[model samples]
Target: MILGWRKRRIARHAGKKNPPGNQEMELVIPNHFRCPISLELMKDPVTLSSGITYDRESIETWLEAGNFTCPVTNSMLRSFDQIPNHTLRKMIQDWCVEKQNYGVERIPTPRTPVTPIEVSEILFDVSASSLDVDQYRCLELVQKIQKWGAESERNRRCIVANGAAAVLAAAFDAFSNDSVERNVAVLEEILSALNWMFPFDVEAQKSLGSRASLGCMIWFLSSKDLSPKQDSIVALKELLACDQKLVEKLSDFEGVNEMLVEFVKKQICPTITKASIMVIFYMVSVAYSSSEKIKLAFVKMGLVSLLLEILVDSEKSICERALGVLCGLCSCKEGREEAQSNALTVPVMVKKILRVSDLATEYSISTISELCKYGRRDEGKILVEALQVGAFQKLLLVIQVGCGDKTKEKATELLKLLNPYRAGLECIESVDFKNLKRSF
Candidate 1:
């Protein structure tokens, strides 16, 4: 996706000639004349299934990004058949000709979109038995076709119709143990193509869930090699998200938790970190209730501390997932104890309340609620520690500014419970602090 953006950016710059010189130089293209997707003058204009029209390349890029609806109308695109707006194309061309002295370039006609027969032939070659040595070429063709599908939902459905996903999965299984570095690179491309398909074609992931394929995933993640690691994370996240049963089966694999922990702690790529956090959250959240050791296994691997580190600078998504894992861990006796025991746990948790997002707010409030409500081992110390972190201030504000009914209720209850300890706090101007003031 990033590469596509980079290509488009270069094309845009390459398309533009130098700015128009001072002919009252409002050198800007008029808004009505612009491509909605690219904001450039329309070239080879084409109308989508919706009534709106855009430059051919711009609209195709949107579709390739896996967008299903018309970017303008949000209408579900009925087909990838982007009909050429011949009238608009001529008008754009005429305008460019009129502005030739102003440095405008003539728009060229776009090539036709890839046909189904072409995609079919590629799929047939992949499925054919003629040459095992030519697997790399076949994989490259699949990647291009998947990318073409990204151009529009119509093209994507075409690729799927031609069995692009099944072929990619088969390729992964075929190359699972090929120790040749070149083969590993091919597997990475195949994995990435699968990642792009995940949002649309989930059944394709079943091929990747096999023991042999999973073993390769772990090997890539654990190995020091950096290039394929991000794709590995994306593939793993999709696989885990699609199959809850897979979550249960993961306990049999060794070092999976530890490997994901290293990814988060290393803070390699934001996407990598986010993906790793989600897989960890799914594993612990889905599996820990049935097994005692799974939740504690996270604690043993320094999961609590690692999550705290992620919370320090990570974005809202990462924050939400980290809190989720903490929630699962805190459900247990040791899990709760480990969270409160961490120095940053209470301070950061309290600070997060209304800060990142509403979801983050929910998990933040829930975490503190666990500490205050279930701080059974050291209830007094837990409440005091929370109070010291300005939990009383934040909770009162939660009630004042308000949140979802569930979150507000939890906050109100915690505030009422801690009311006896509130005295110098300024935000608690309400009656909730009356009892706590007397105690102080």
Candidate 2:
């Protein structure tokens, strides 16, 4: 009994020495041995089973931050389910009243720094461990962070930025091997922190670096390797829906849009590893976007023509990717086909395929020959005329080198139909039949 009285007395008198607004006031604690939620003597002084509790505002500073365990039970609490213990709440309120009557003034403390070290320390705490934060505590951390803003000591802003990256990396690592809905929460937090860090420091959003970070996160979230539980799907969809804030940020970030345009227009190729597909998809379909700059960037980079030309590349994967993008464009609301036509899309594709057929592997020769055979029908005679001028001879040369029986059979059939002999005789005096026979 005496010990409790002495503790209260100490708390009360300690408040006096600090005085209001004194620098020393920052360290003072309220004079109470009570829980904020339950008004009574905190029996176990434990955090509730649900991971949150309401306490009298007076005893708020007394609780250890990010700790959710009931001081009494010591049982692990899940964050989302925490409910306030009102009885303990009332007791603390009563104590505050008594302290007020006794002329004890409360000294309010500013929030602690949110530096890397602080974030690291907090992560090991129980509350974050349980993945829960009550409203008041969240507000407190925000206030604290805001108070410490820009001018914060100990290089706090950078700490928060790096700390956020660490947390995001941890979340990604956790889900790297297994797909889980929990990944969404962690991803969202990472994105939020990235946003926070950007305004706080420009380096936080490195043009290439942030793109890579987000690219990785998006890849993991949409990874086909993972189970892709329903929740994960929903979460990914939500993220893709639209980010007004990100759009605004991009508008102000100077080079972000241009960087994105460059990546989309010139960087992606089908030869890229499988793990990178989702990122490519997201960048094309979501991130790089449909803005005029992006559209013009593609045009400026000659992507439209290059993409069509690449469709006939000897590399199957590269051809497939280019084809896929073309197919996707055909299905869009944009007059992609119209643009292609106006921009010499058909002529370019036909010309490239014809040329590829002349020098490509037999497999490529067969595919391009078949495409050319059927393509000129829909694409027109101009394309076929382009192919007849000894181009078929070059194609036969390639076919002879690598063509399997089936490929040779197809090439023969195409040759019968294309008959470059007459055109070859008329155009070039000497026929390169030696090389052509070698291909055959």
Among these predictions, the greatest TM-score belongs to: 1
At residue 88, give the lDDT of candidate 1. 84
Question: Mind giving the per-residue lDDT tens digits that candidate 2 earns over 1-440?
Answer: 11122123234556544334442221223435534445434422323444445332322333335554544455555542334454554555455456553444332322333445666564344134324423234334433443444444334444564444344334333333233343444443333333334332222223213433344444534444433222222222233333323332333334433433344344343222221222222333433445434444434544455555445433544444444444333333232433334434433443333233333233333334434454544333423543544446554553546546765676676666656434534232133443333322
Q: Write the per-residue lDDT of candidate 1 for residues 108-134, one digit (tens) a residue.
A: 765566677988887777656213745
Model 1: lowest-lDDT 10 consecutive positions? 1-10
Clash counts per candidate, in order, are 5, 26
Root-mean-square deviation (CA) per prediction: 8.3, 22.8
Local distance difference test scores for all models: 0.73, 0.40
